[model samples]
Target: MDDWVDPGETLETASFERLYRGALELASSVERTRAATLVLLTGRLGLTLEEALHCNEGWVDWERAELQVPEKDPCACAGCWELARRRREHTDPIREVLYEECWSPSPDRAPRTVPFGWSRRISAALLATADRYLLDLLPGDARELLRAAGEAADGIEPDDLTPGLLAATTVDFLSDLGLEADGTAAVLGVGEARVEPYAAAGESDVTTRMARLAGVDGSADPESAFPVACGTEAFESEPFDVGAADADALAERATATDAPERVPRPTDLPASVDYDPADHAAAGGPNRRTDAGSWAEGPSAADGNENALRADGASAVTGADRGRAGLPDDPSTASGSQATAPDVTCARDVVTQPVVADFSTRAAADGLCGGREIPGRVILGQEELFVLWSEEKGAEDADAPHLLVPLEDVWDVRIDDVPGRLSASFPHAVTVGHRPSGRDELAVSIQLPPAQRRDMASALYRILLNVTPMTVVDPAREGGRVTDADPEEMVLYVRPHGVAFTDEAGDAARLAFDLSDVVDVERIERSFDGESRPAVQLRRVTDNRPVTTVVTAADDRLRRLVWRYVRREYHQTLATVRGIRLSDAEKMVMVALYSTDGTPDLGSLLDLTEQELSAALQSLAAKELVRSAEAATDLTGTGQLAVSDRLESVNH
Candidate 1:
């Protein structure tokens, strides 16, 4: 039985709780130095001061981090040290800890050793597994971490002693590789970390403050979040600057340069912004030039304003010698002559690019591993189709959209319907799962799109309108050929169509059913004797629709029975597949482990204490069946060897 506190135990009692409580109470009532006295007595001596103050004092260690005590020595320092000198003594050596160390399973057992080449291979394996499982679902950071773990596992030696360092290193590696974007990190199961790019161009002071505010000293739930702080700081330091030196001066200068308009003035300004075509041949001419049409909502050709900006500063200089062209070299206009300049311009039209249509096609079909098909129909559950079809190059002007067709309309099924895609299946079928009492419909494996999800109940209601009922058929007595000359010989014929038969009287018959309608047919035969050359004889019945045949031999019958048992229970022959069933093994292991406390090395299963057995079992994991229930706790205070011994016993 486990130990419980005694009723008579008090401050003077030798029980652990009593001494510990007395020390705590005594220390609290006295000064700090006096508290030290209580600590020394209870922690180092493991006894009350009254019980341990009289023991020897040579076991104390003032330099090293430990206290050495002889196996049989009853060392005590309470009486040896005077009260005044205790405070100045070196740090105490014997530290007493009360809590148990909770042991979690170690991923590996051997000491660390660097395996550079092997680590790479391991990383490649991990990457391949991740790729195969569709787990590239994490944010960039997490994805990077997974990738890093793979790399590190490949490159590192076995002797690395960093504690929880591997996990962190992987996180950092992912961030460095820019794999932390989107949602990669979380999907990859990598731990969190902070990543900052453009740090050089970024404001260091602001980032530091933000980082500090979110660090250890920061409030767990502050009034403001970290991102908010960064945003607020940016806003306060750099508000919009429309009046800055860059473009504001140009706008201001342009205002002063314009001449006042006259009531009876020409539709265009005498000297307005405009392009001159002659300037096109000149060096360093206008980088861009446009006519009235350039302005999206500008005057049209019918408007007089279209050609009125010939002298405007916006016009390009066609030639440096403008005076020879009868135009004022400076801003002054020529006397009564139109100041003309060649228009150097180009027209640019903005067009919209249509979105390219794309989609994938998946069918609701049988899974290759295990499932069933009903008559004239097949039931598929969470089945996935992965087709590799390349998208057609988009025509420059077409608006074509892609579509997905499920089941390809059942009536159109053909031998080559799913070329290169063959499926082998088991017999379980899908059905509506459990639901809340008031819930009237089942949810689909894939959630409905937003439009449909909004009214899932209604969508499901419409779906249930056309669901067909399943049909069942028996195969025995369907069709078989019987020989008239030999009453014991019966031949059964099975075809893609319903089973057919021929009686001993030379009569042929066929069942009126679809080939898909039949599931299984059993030929029941009775075996009597334990041994015989033929082993059994057929007992025939003429009036049993088609015919009936029974065999005789106990051994033959027993062998057949076992075959049927396997078909009914497992639904498949064990020797035919490669897989493991862990449920039965789990039950057996638990029984053995719990009953016998395992020993060190776990070599001996017959003799084990409860603690040893518990530890042994806790160190290992059950590997066979898929566990559907809660797991049992492990034993403590026992070493690995003891646990291993117990495990071997339980397993054996």
Candidate 2:
């Protein structure tokens, strides 16, 4: 069954069926090409609204029955360039650096070929949709179509309709007509085929399949396969048999019976626990407690308790508290407090020791020197590596002139022997290769002190390995023929946008997979030369082929680390594709809740007004990403995933 539904409202099965039928009828009234385009792209092919817009007729291979989606090149148009230029004008160097380097405008669209075969009706509709030129339907047109469909189904608001919602409904409608395995398998080509009782049919056998789907078998009633109108005599008279019945038949039976006991409505259910707003306010909002003695002590005593509560609930222990308790807050500090509050460690607390170095920059385009070396203190931060050149050492000022390099952009970092003209104290040179604007690589070089040289080098190596290129051999192709052995030795590079395998010199890419395309990543033990060794396995789909590759590193630790990085990258990338962008206030509230135990006084902590906090919470709750009950607000599973994605970007 299709899991996706319209976010604005949850429709009952009967209402959804009515809506589906109405939509199909409404679609039939539109221009044949437009109607076909709407139904085929979203319903059969399962392309998202954005993907459907970018699609061209030429992408479809008639002979292979496949649609080949090409990678999108970064836009060089005047409008796009203007936007990019304006984005780079931020006053904060760190923000500017992140926007330029770490952040990507869109998720990676690696070239993908999806094999698809549909019933004759769908095939004819698609052919008509793509007459001579590529289907050039606009977003407004798609919206209008969905709006009309909504209106036809008992006046659902046009504003509540979204492309994703409509597409999901269409898929569900088709699935009811017995195309579940075929349609779902074709859409999800990365996995094994789903088993069904009916033999999978080809285009020629589509007519028979359609007939079977419609319940046209000798003894079955044709109308039995579809949903019946609610409260109708025909619906009540018809006997429902659960055996061998599809979803529509079940829905029809359920709707006809008006079984409130079977399908309880949210509005009809009574509250599990009575909550009094008056009592809540008298207690001084959600975060404040009202124990018998505390409440009797009045507002003054309540204030002190609130402060104490804040101290206990706050994830990070302050310097004042550390001194008063005579216990260090650092987890590494040999103390029992670490065990008691294991989650106290925040991302900001994990800062690397600063190393004195000389920094220089070179233009990526021309490979020419952009600046001369300047003495500075280099610090490896949670988010980025920065160099502060101010004479006042040990001072960390945001406004000071500094060079910031986002960690996500640092693809490669290697230590080299320092040459002449540099300080003798800084004897080692560390070179970083990164793409600031998703263009050519910019090289940032720093000469590190001899004492902390290895420490800094190892730190960079460990943290940046996700983006660094590593030599890997494809075990499957190791003993294959010479012609098929080209991929035996390749360099694998995992970036925020995508994963790619290139030649030894990293000049030409042999294979590349979008983070979205990677369906699975696993760590497994592989036997080589009668010895067991750890390896990472990646599985992706390409041109109807489920490609699996096992990658091994020089040691078990490195391989395990690679697996972790790959999995993390995959999750983060998937989260971005959800099309959910939280506002600044929403983010602050989410992070505060994620980092702290119980609910903090969000209004005070985030400096948000009561109205603003309420609005943000409502929006989050509507999206099903957050859950709140009375005084406590917590993240739903989806909310946790979203927050984790955001935290990874900051903590990396």
Candidate 3:
């Protein structure tokens, strides 16, 4: 049983209540040194101060920045809300946590090394202050000393670790990286330091703060968060440079320095940003919105406004849902009424079941690897997707599978097929992932039966294909950056049509080629540490050129998936052409046309052919690979349109 006390349970006890009351007093010390006492006790008690203080407050949890307090639930007991440090991960097989599935399967094992990486824990301490009760405790029941102290447990909060040193370190770190220290300081808006750390701190914490300082933060929330803080000491020390604070001066300086406008003026909106029904129809698809509203808002408009100042609310709004798209999540809406007991009818009857698809049934995923929860199958719970294991060998053991990918967290997928598995899959696995801002994309593979692999590939492709476009720009710029730079010189971003790269700052240049144009992709290998680290290389339609671009973190799966998608039409065309029985001469003509720009030497094809030249011309044209320009045909737009659309039309 867990030793941590639940305030709701123990608060009624008079002795325990008195001890908790004392902890509260010591924890929030006006005399900073007393706060140190609370910190010390947290270590001794083996709980983070936040976890400790939360152990009290009716076991209230002031979760992260918005301070969400989840209502108590059946599983919100001391075991899951552990008071002890994590020597081993909690699991469903043992610890009854918040939800059966929320239980992590990984175990705490010492790192594999010649000498064990960790072991041997022992502790001793010298105390300066003691009470009569403390004197008795030294030689008294060992349980009392190790047993969680009620007074200490009821009131510990995480140390917002004085932000002074952290803040200075951040500024100095940026300066050392060749950034102008004063310019960076001015951008942060303090007199070199102090007075409210990263204003973004209210909405974010340490991880978010570091991302912003390094100019790499993305709009997506961090996987976890911890608080950051600072006090008023630097503000009290000195005051300087009051004039740079003037809004008009800042604006004037921005204009004089040729900085880009933070938002497009309504008058400056690109024509492409406006909706057009005709173009959508021509693409063989209907517009997603028929309300005559714009369908082409700038790519980042949907997700990039979280850090925007409240004063800039007008600019932050998107064309959809009247700017509601950019709003931060509201914590107040999360009070989902206390988790409650269910009536008998609330549970699904297990006696009878309806038919399920063969592919979706557990039997389909069940393979030589035992059970429904296999290494390749997705584990669903908490409305998310995760693969149970990364590798299958000995995966029956919970601790062996070190990787678990929450499926919905995946943003992009690229499959690379390996020889051996049917039609082309190595062990029939594909990797799916998301690219974070300018960072490399992360991919994890899930093995599948060949029958299921095709279905999974299509579903994953459609999922990533539909995500609204994203553009990555330098995060440190006061105003955002949008560019028209060439793909070779820009940071890569995904769009519905293809990936884009911007070579210049602001609205200078953007190079986005259609996905259809990508001809091939290859993996670039690196082995600096005797382990393979590879990047992706993409080639456009012209195969002779060196690979067009290399995307970091793009694994074998991405390389394969891109080529698979890009060559579907090419393969289809070849399949259709191969159906016809074309002689060597006719086949040679088409091959030459495909290879050299659009013109082919049918003269060589017709000059030494066993068949008549007229017959050869008719034969090639029948396959739609080539057509006769001199044939008797209507002088209508059809001829001109055909020439523009087809590869080439040669004269007889």
What are the C-alpha RMSDs, in order, of all predicted structures? Answer: 37.1, 31.7, 31.3
Q: Of the pair 2 and 3, which is ahead by TM-score?
A: 3
- Tens-digit lDDT track for model 2 on 75-119? 212232234445665464322322233111124223445433223
lDDT of 3 at 520: 42
List model 3 lDDT by residue over 1-652, tens digit each. Answer: 1232321222222332233233334322221122322322232122233222222111111110011112221222233323112333543322222222121111211111010000000000001111101111111221222232342444422121222222333333233233343333432223423322322212112222323332222332222221110111111111212212222232232233232111111122234334221221111111111011111122211223221212211212112111122333433321111112311121111111110111111111112233222323232211122333323211333332223333334555433222111111112244455433444555444443332343445444432222222222221112123323222323233333344443322122344454544444455563323555564444443221212544432344334444444344334333334334556555445444444434334455335554565565566566443544543211111112222233343221
Question: Can you write out model 1's per-residue Cα lDDT over 510-542, one digit (the tens) per residue?
Answer: 222222221222444422232222222221112
For lDDT, the strongest prediction is: 2
Stretches > 4 Å off in candidate 3: 1-359, 362-404, 408-455, 462-520, 525-535, 542-582, 594-596, 608-652
Q: Which ranges in model 1 have alpha carbons more than 4 Å from their true place?
A: 1-404, 408-607, 616-652
List per-prediction Cα lDDT, in the order shown: 0.22, 0.43, 0.28
lDDT, candidate 1, residue 477? Answer: 31
Residue 322 of candidate 3: its Cα lDDT? 19
User: Which pairs clash in model 2?
Assistant: none
User: Which predicted model would earn the best TM-score?
Assistant: 3
Worst 10 residues of 3 by lDDT: 115-124
**How does each model score on TM-score?**
0.15, 0.24, 0.26
